[model samples]
Target: MPNFKLVAPYCGVRKYDKRFFVYYLETEENIRREYIFNTDEDVSNFSHALENLTAFMNNVPVCKKEAYHQEFLDLLLREVDHKLNIRTDPSKPSAVALAIEA
Candidate 1:
């Protein structure tokens, strides 16, 4: 399995107006690939997990890395969950987008 780093993230509707959350990951070789979730539930779930991970990471800081690490994480989380999520959701109709819409 190739190791890839998360590069960019975007969410929106796909073909058929299906909700989508897509991440562009790049391998060390500079190969880029799309990791897409077409269902709102999957997108919501993943964002919740990512949000939680970002929060957990903030609690532990390393020497000389504190200044920029949290900023990077905040940017990453905000970008990935651009629409924002009000609560955990497991059904369709994006929890993230829905919250923003409301």
Candidate 2:
């Protein structure tokens, strides 16, 4: 297996064949590094893991000596909402946004 490095905050999944798919991350240097996932379950797990990793990376302050977990989670959600162009209100999200999130 090729050693892959994740250097970006964004990722994408691409279908490679009937029985295989590629999970790739866009590096900060504009390079795309990919890994193969052979099963649907593997793909799903990869997606979830990547989402959680990025969420933590984006919210946790690297320079800070200490940070509250709850505060970081709240900030992360706010950042996600802003990026998705969703309203800050507690109202239900639109169908399109929901689809995108899913």
CA error at residue 9 for candidate 1, angstroms:
15
Candidate 1, clashing residue pairs?
none
Residue 97, model 2, lDDT: 30
Q: What does candidate 1 score in Cα RMSD to the true structure?
A: 15.3
Q: Write the per-residue lDDT of candidate 2 for residues 1-102, one digit (tens) a residue.
A: 222223122333333331222222222233222344445665555556545655566665655312343243345344231111112323443232333355
Error of 1 at 56 (Å): 0.5
> What TM-score should be assigned to candidate 2?
0.34
Could you say which candidate leads in lDDT? 1
| Candidate No. with top TM-score | 2
Task: Write down the lDDT of every candidate, Cα atoms only.
Answer: 0.37, 0.36
Q: Could you give candidate 1's per-residue lDDT for residues 1-102 as a string of tens digits?
A: 122222222222121132323322212222212334446765666556545644555565544233443355456546453342222233344433334355
**33, model 2: CA deviation in Å?**
0.9
